[model samples]
Target chain A: MQETRLDTARIRAARQVIDPIFLDTPLYRCEALEPVLGCAVSIKLETANPVRSFKARGTELVASLLAGRAAVCASAGNLGQALAWSGRGRGLDVTVVASRFAPAAKLDRIRALDARLELVDGDFDMARERAAAIARSDGIRLVEDSLDIETCEGAATIGLELVDAAPPFDAVLIALGGGALATGVGHVVKTWAPGVEVICVQPLGAPAMTHSWHQRRVVTTDSTDTIADGVAGRRPIPAVLDDLLVVADDAVLVREESIVAGMRMLLDHAGLVVEPSAALGIAAILEDRDRFADRHVATIVCGGNVDMDAYHRWVGARS
Target chain B: MQETRLDTARIRAARQVIDPIFLDTPLYRCEALEPVLGCAVSIKLETANPVRSFKARGTELVASLLAGRAAVCASAGNLGQALAWSGRGRGLDVTVVASRFAPAAKLDRIRALDARLELVDGDFDMARERAAAIARSDGIRLVEDSLDIETCEGAATIGLELVDAAPPFDAVLIALGGGALATGVGHVVKTWAPGVEVICVQPLGAPAMTHSWHQRRVVTTDSTDTIADGVAGRRPIPAVLDDLLVVADDAVLVREESIVAGMRMLLDHAGLVVEPSAALGIAAILEDRDRFADRHVATIVCGGNVDMDAYHRWVGARS
Candidate 1:
């Protein structure tokens, strides 16, 4: 089967629009984690953004594209803040529909970004559905995570940066969420650094991508729960699934406890404050350190939008 | 009085030793704060390091310069972890003398950096005295904070980056500790952008630099306390004092409450997790927002090495 490729022209155009507002997050060698893994390891720090997440890149691109249109989206956390901030920059109205489960700090952030907040009933799926309906009714553009090609392209820039900054790695561990980040990053790595393995890591409780990969089709679950709130989801977007299948060499589901451990490792060793989803790749590595031993690896610290309360709980729970 | 000029040749040589190990942190426009400040506000994000602080640069430089020599340093938090990490990288034995007041997580980080940790009996002063004694008695190279010219030059790279990255600003806000960061940054800013204002910000409770500036001489106090632990000191080093006096346009003392507010603001608006010292400049801005309402301004986010427990307490206290 032919691999589905990103529209380079569209990506280039989106890059031009988003370049001014977005940051080119740095890619640096993780000397500390290297010895533990027994391989040369580098980390692409996407947490350095003004919004402290990679969602800034995707949402910035989406917001820029919808310059004249009202922008709407549903997010668990980081995406809402990103969209709200980007929308504020462009002088566009933004409405964020968030699940009740979303952190108070994240909701506060969305409001701080000057976005109209809608607290929806039920989980993320229901919130997203409500957002989509509002967008359709109000003639606003719903910047759905899976449907936005620009979001994926924006994320692909990470792969581009990694390939440009560091030597070829044996594997790239990416946290799988709406699949845009993994699919986009995987596309670039598989295409440009063909020898490098691309591993998509998902939370065990929400293994939509893993299930999709095994079944060779898009999959969705009725119920999903995980500590990695950013990547906790049921549905796999078909467009992203096609790209993930083509580009990803393997998939791993990390335990929640390990994810907490990864977060602790990040804080203690790397001095990084990352959310559970951001630590998913590290969690995967921690699960079977020997498997990644003696192989050059790169893991994306995708976001740092964890709420203070959640962080306190996780730290307390882990300690 | 003449300024203590940075030895550019030495800084250039030091860069060769340190560049590979440390990140060249970004100097970019603070878009969110700029409109409020009414001047072009830029910030140097030195917090995007392994230790999540600018101390990494100085520690790396000092460690590399020490070559095969054993190293010792006294730190509130960031410096110890930085030295530990850099020392480990070079296979040098490192001992960090930290005060009991320092964060537990910071001690963990120092250990994680593979350094020998020594918890001192008292505050940062006692830690410094102990480190100095150890270095002298054991023939280990002491990576003293303000007294070391190399450390200052290493930090001066922040100024160099700022000058190269952004156009000249009217003022630059720096949080002063033992004065290494302020002196280094001030030296470069004054040399490169002569017209730029250099404002030194100190916590009201720990006003070593402020007292020195007022008395027109180095000042010392028996004890000092402030939420901005990174900048909380009772004495100013004479080596940095002369340069600080010559280059620093003025100095401001920020209230503890304002500094806490600044931290929350960064987390809320800028999506940044900054320690109190890093927020001092922003705190100063917020304190007198009308004064800076319309000026081209720049500030350094010196470090991000706050204790989680301390952070929780500070935020809780503020609320």
Candidate 2:
């Protein structure tokens, strides 16, 4: 198979250029998870960063390269905050178009990072269209998640940090949304340590990435209803779709119920209160324990955006 | 004042001797928290370790020095698990004396780490008494938390890693129990960066450490009636009490209500499901936000051994 992973050397450079806050995060063994999953699980937590997500890495590199150019983008929350925060260092101002109904905490973070917010009445897709239109009219560059090479290369820094984990991991599980995070991490993992398998996990509610990978083309779902807002995407990013075809060894879809269960387990056992999307990796492992039994597995905990009300409601429903 | 902090040289040496799992934890700026508290708050998360606590650092160093000798210790939970996990490397079998009423999840973790469990019929102090008796009869060493210099030296390694933060913090907040974690961390901060203030946090329900600091000697309380089991010691360790006089600048006692509030905030904002004792630092901050306002402050997030039901009840109470 012709593999077109992110440039290995560029990833190394990106690690140096990106914001240090996202660098060298905690990659520790979740002791309770080992017995439950019947495997040694090392979690690379992205929540420790200033942005509380891995989005900062890619955005930091992208903004640094923008070189004072103003950029317009659409995001539910994480990417917008990353861009706004990283852009400050490079004098690249950001105009983020986001859903009016987005979480207050995320919206507050973006604003605090000094991003100018354009609140749209409709959902995430509508926000994207508004960003594109604003970019055209205002003459600012429009950056989309999972579609840019600089973004993916910057995120590949996860590969650099994972080297520190004792009893090196054999396989990696990552939640696939627009595919930037998975492809970036997979690219580095495949390049730095060949034969290490990369598995993409997608929510059953937001199965665009998984569907597209299987069909060998882009896939669009009617709507994404997953509580994991970070990985809930309706349409597949074409560039990321192509990237995953080369880098992703396999993909799995997990139920929303399993996502809730995974989130609860992580809270109770691992002491992490991550977004439902972050739970997708754990959800996948829990859903199919036989496939991963006794394997040295690692997963990227991509975000920690859930609030108390939402967290309580999700976990409380099961009880 | 000729301060005898844990030999700064020994802390450097302990880094090489201790278990690797306890090193290089995530220390990052909690951006959301800064805005709320009106200060720059950097948190050193110790809960990321294999045992989900900083106790591993101390025990690892202690066990390594023991050279396969059997040891008996009494713990509420975190210390026992840390000893059990770290001792496995040095072939030091551990006998943990725990309260019969200890949390099932914590007890299970200690047992899983292959420690011999002795559940005493009374409270934590009674368990300590039982452990002392066991050590006397078995001719094994009885290692206490704060009395041991090697253990404190091991935990001081956190100070080594905190140098990575961009702006130097002016103050540090830590939860004090038997005081191994606080004294060790304080010892490093005091020796290396003398001006940085060390503030110890004790549960209002368990104010032995704070009371002892005021009295300039050991203090014993009738009962420790707080939800933060990790820092609920009825009696202060004498060596640590003296260590606090030189290394610590101040001590604050926080109410249980604030701990629940602090835990909720970390869950909602920082994405950490920590022990109520770990919440004590934030609780102290919450209890007196004005005192920390505009200061570059740091806190040690010491443990995350909370069970699902306890977590649900604590955070769920607010909703």
Candidate 3:
């Protein structure tokens, strides 16, 4: 196996630098969910913070390091909001590029956070290209979500906290996006608590990261279609794929129907208004009940920034 | 004012005895809620814990003090779950009495927590009588939710946390139940952060606590009707009423419509699936926006235990 470059020491150091609001989130057994999931389920809730997502942890760390400098990033929603929020009060300047088709709620939030918002005519890929062009032309740094080592290190802090959860989970499930959350968390859990399996979940509509992880190389899809915009990455970052190669034990693609059902399950059982992306972990469990049955399983409810209209359309339909 | 007996020192002391899981809950400003609420709002979330309510703080403290003893209490749902959960590892034996009409979700949760449950044929008052009878006949302790000093003291810990919230709030709002959470939090806030107004909220359908607070005496209503079962007290405890008289600076009663609206607001803007009882504070603000507009205000999102059917009927309807 190739020697892992993701440093446990730096990940540990990132803990102190990450905002306290993102640290020590609720990690407890959801008895209500256990019966439904057919497993002893523990939820690591990352939605209770200001940005309503775990993306802030990495963005905050990355912003802190880039203090007094301007940075640009392309996001469907969450990463942009995190960057704008973390950049505020700090000397750092942030510009977010998003597709015109991005959720209005997310775009409005990004603007409210005082970040520069640039709307592209095309999809997320085009937005990424626009961000890169802006960064080059404006002589500013382009901060890629998972491609940044600091972003991964910041996310690894969650793994540190997860290992300390009582009764100890047999497996940990993470939502796979550009691979920051999954790989970052996977690295720490695999390195420290080797006994616990790190399973990454992706929407079947957008399974580039999962496919790339399995193939042990970079992969791209022609298009993406999913309610879980957070994990709908058509193109997987090669560096993050490398991290997943060593760290992630397995990756699963869940049906779109399962995502909606998972959202309803979380709302009914756990009293959480989670985005579809956050529901992917639960959907993964719902897809393969036998693998997790009777075992203590932990999953990070990673975000809760869903648009109300979409939420009603998706989850309300199930109810 | 009459001499205050809800001890600030005991409330502070109770902090250490309470479960760590119930302490240091998310206390942050929700920006998305600000525009809708017409104010700078900070939500003290008590819903993300094991029991999904602030009830655990008091129950844990009360349970700890009653170590190796048998205790009984009547609850709508949250309190019973708290007691059952808190009394688990301890030598304490817990019994919960409830009206047959109590939400099935709560009943199932209480039963799951290993507490002995007694269902009464009539209302909550009938359940209370049954609990008292059980206590007397079995030689067990009758643990009143707010009447017990430890319960209030445990709840007072939230006030301690609130006073430390950043940018400092102009006023704090709390949902009125048996008066433990409101009076406990009020006593601490009024005593320590006297500049911050302690406002208590009750549903218009069940305004016994509000009426009692305004009238400066105990008051009883023939019936109570509200979706917020946690705060649907028809009769106010005289002792807890006395504490409320001293601690609470103001009390507001909001309509059932407003309570439903508040739940929707929390769900849409704050990304929290709070129950009607927990939404009382938000309802109060919505009813009288002029009183809270532009002011920095704090409200305890005190619980998240709601029947899914009720959630859909109330919040889902608005969407």
- Predicted structure with the largest TM-score when compared to the true one: 3
Candidate 3 DockQ category? Answer: medium
* Model 1 residue B274 CA deviation in Å: 4.7
lDDT of 3 at B278: 89
What is the full ranking by TM-score, best candidate first?
3, 2, 1
State candidate 2's DockQ. 0.55
Better of 1 and 3 by DockQ: 3
Error of 1 at A294 (Å): 5.9
- Model 2 segments beyond 4 Å from truth? A1-5, A163-166, A317-319
TM-scores of the models, in the order given: 0.82, 0.95, 0.96
Local distance difference test values of all predictions, in order: 0.79, 0.84, 0.88
Q: Per-residue alpha-carbon lDDT of model 2 for B189-251, expressed as tens digits? A: 877787888899988899998999988988899988989888778877777788888888999
Pitting candidate 1 against candidate 2, the one with the higher TM-score is 2
Candidate 3 structure quality by residue, lDDT tens digits, B81-168: 9999999867789999998888888999999989999999877877888999999999999998888888888888999998877678
Show the lowest summed lDDT stretch of 10 residues, model 3 chain B.
B310-319
Per-residue C-alpha lDDT of model 1 across residues B132-221, encoded as one tens digit per residue: 999999988888897888778888777776776544677889998888888888888787787878899999989987889877898888
Model 2 chain A: which ten-residue window has the lowest total lDDT? A310-319
lDDT (Cα, tens digit) per residue for candidate 2, span A98-215: 9887777788889988889999997777888899999999999998887877778777888777754556788899988888888888887776666778999998888988999999
Q: What's the residue-level lDDT of A1 in candidate 1? A: 26
